[model samples]
Target: MRWSIPRSDAVDVLREQLRKQVRAPFAATAGMVVLLWASLTPSLMPRTALFQALLTALCMLAGYGAGALAGWLVRSCGGRLAGRARVIAWRVLAGVAGIGTLIVLGLSLRWENEVRDLVGVDRVGIWHLVLTVLITAVLLALLLGLSRGIRALGRSIGRFVGRFLPAAASTVIGGLIAAVLIYELAIGVGGNRLLGALDSSFATINQEFRTEIPAPTTPELTASPASSQAWEDLGRQGRVFIASAPTAADIGEFTQEPAQQPVRAYVGAGHEGVDIREEASAAVTELDALGGFDRAVINVVTGTGRGWVNENQAQALEFMWGGDTATVSLQYSYLPSWMSFVLDRQRAQDAGLALFDAVYGRWLEIPEAERPLLVVSGESLGSFGGEAAFSGAQDLATRTDGALFVGPTADNRLWSRFTEEREPGTPQVLPILDDGEIVRFADQPEQWDLPGAWEGTRIGYLQHANDPITWWSPSLALECPDWLEEERGRDVSPNVRWIPGVTMLQLGVDQFSANSVPQGQGHQFGTAPVYAWAEILPPPGWSDERTDELAVVIGDRAWLR
Candidate 1:
């Protein structure tokens, strides 16, 4: 009779156990907090106070929301798994079936476009997708495990500190410590090394591609003793591999060619034996010797880390000015631009600022009425470095008559500022400030219709929708970027969905694949520059027919090839 009077103890015990499941939510939220703190911010140095606060608040809310959803899912499903043996068996079979289904679906999915978008080849196999999925899954699982470990470690420390200090103080200290450790382990060691290896490997291949392209030469550059000595100094002392300029004969034959041949002064200081400042000085001397100041447009160019002066840009300027422009640039580093972006942005800034300053100082010495139009131009890392010369947009406006930066990196302070303070409702990718008064951005040729023909000193930033260099940032994890929310870039996959951790990883992969396709087709502005510059620095009485012709010639040259 007493045994039949069951004590409701079992029910009480089950309730207590269910209540203890609160830790899952806490753990998940803590893990998310650690991840957000460790990785989601773009840079430790916030560009502005408001932006920093906004990022923090957004991440915190996202982390908490994700944690709550995860907790709800776990709790809702926890009781369904009853007997341990049955639960284990179900898990095993479900895993097998899940994998088999994934394999079948992945093989069936049309991945040709995805592969082509990534590496410019449509020759992808089902095995490739399987392998990619496998690798990505492993990495993501590892990240989750690491985040969990961090949260556990932080909680344990917080409990320990709470014994000797206030609970709030203990929590704060524990969080700060966990954040530091996670950052060091996740970003400083693992991510940096991974990015470096990818960059270095690609650079080796890139260098081979560059070395194969024979450097152009002309007799006119080597005609006089002084010119030959300057050319020799550029080649020997300057450690330059290529120094080319159009001869009188080449310029005379312009009627047959779509673009007029112009003087191009380049000091190849890319290798280890070169001195940056010395080579810059040599480049200025060579340009002066070539009578560059007498040209209608004098362009101070910035090279990528590997010393590529973006021939597309140079060709555009030459065609615009009817081959009357003088372009001068010097090599700063031999590493690929992505490498320098990750490793040595300062060197680019130094080279760009120094070269422009030297050239500008010399240009200032000439009579204002007689001096050639002083213009500054750079692409990719060149743009990042070139913008370093100006303190702000106003500084750029005052210092130079015209500036054109193509595919400027996201971290470029000037680009960031202008984009932020741009006209309300203007797309970030193509902002038109003050009706294109002083600054304008263009994604393609047609979008360059500046109202009233912007008659004063102006700057144009040309960035494609698909260029990772223009869009990638740490904040992408928690907040949707403007580019992704609107029209996806031409090269980007339309099905590219944004998941929390998954999207961040995908973009990282995208950054590497950005240059895989031919230039102008992807990150390279092959023919776009011709169209972009035509709008930015349109020649007096320039016609659409001429612009189309310039594009055709620039595409035909394909100088990088």
Candidate 2:
């Protein structure tokens, strides 16, 4: 009581306390900036590209400014909710926010007719999505609470370790332990549920929409030299659909000779959804049985949610080759391809390796003179996985005769590498590599107008400029990709412009809407498959007229999704 400070000293002490109080919001703002920067840096910032780096820096700064604004908002509202009245007010505010969110979601559901058409579902499914979001939010809150407890446990351990070790070291160890615990919990509990919530309702309805295919009849299987023992055996071997070339009598007027009849074999990934490798092995064996050695074999890897090969591509190959080609494929996953990639990319990659390896192994056994030219093809997520079979152009050249990956995802490693390392003046979407020798990217067949006869094993990627699958990436949240500046795909809206975060969010929505348009005309590549295949494997007697004719036929035919 006797130790009274001087007035000047007391004023200084008060100022210090005020400064400390003011520091809290600024510190929080700094932390937010760090978090957002760390999250976005991996996607936005490329090591070599100057524009990407500069743009990423700007994005980081913008995020920091947002964080600052949030900090100010938090500080302004800090002491408003203190007593009983404040508590009640908070409850009212939360209720208002919830109602507002629901209203917004309802409006969105009403506005997004294109998404409804694309997904081929009704309002009930949209309502399910709303429920999914709410449930997911609740689960996330629970996880956050659990994480807090875990973090406390980690801190307690750190305190204990502090007695035995240096403070910095103990703190680091504790943080690492906490991180590991959180990661394990995320995987062990939340991973499956989180993924399922994305599209489970839609997938359920989609599965219901699939038509039940009948197994091959005894008469059909035993139909003389025209009937394939392998094709008939597929029914017993558990394939979903086996469409062998119809005999002369079966096709009636449409029948060309037995030599011109193509063999198409496909097996489902079980209605129950079993292992991919086993199914792939089974598909390879079926390919072998169905005269794969005698025909130019195209082993296609079907996208997730697709139960069959790209019918147009397969049919085009058969048509171009005069029925001297066979296509084999198997279902890998039941979830929609976009969802599958988000949930379990490794499965797709594994399927690609297993199927390709099995076919290549079998293909090797045949004598060089008699061995059919082996080719690989895939589309969308199918392309992403199929590309995993090769490390680069050299690897592709050595492994397969020719390959076609249509609508390739931006993350495809080989595609990215090739595009990045292409010769100068080459466009990002359709890069001409090594004078169109090893591999070339193409938006259309006309871009492949190289001088003289094209040399080397051909691997073409057909990515439409407008395809969301080809361009969507986390980086779009910050900066535009080069593809946007160059010639846009025929279908892409001219009004489409890159607006940083807005564009990113818009494209995410566009992914759902893309399927509303007809295939080939949009991302599905409609009649483009016939043209693409013709370029990749120029069959004997193939002409522009023939390709155009087949394109028309393929467009007219119904294909299984």
Best by TM-score: 1
Q: Per-residue CA lDDT of candidate 1, range 292-354, in tens?
A: 777888888887876777766776777667777788887776566787777767878888888
lDDT of 2: 0.61
In the predicted model 1, the residue pairs found to clash are 240-268, 520-524, 520-526
Deviation in Å, model 1, residue 98 alpha carbon? 1.5
> What are the lDDT figures for the candidates, one per model?
0.64, 0.61
TM-score of model 1 vs. true structure: 0.69
> Against the hidden reference, what TM-scores do the models get?
0.69, 0.64
Which ranges of candidate 1 are over 4 A from the true structure? Answer: 1-125, 133-251, 256-261, 270-278, 487-494, 518-520, 558-561
Residue runs of model 2 more than 4 Å from their true location after superposition:
1-188, 193-213, 217-260, 271-273, 305-308, 487-495
RMSD of candidates 1 onward, in order:
10.7, 11.6
What tens digits encode model 2's per-residue C-alpha lDDT throughout 288-330? 5655556765545555444434566666676666666667766
The clash number for model 2 is: 4
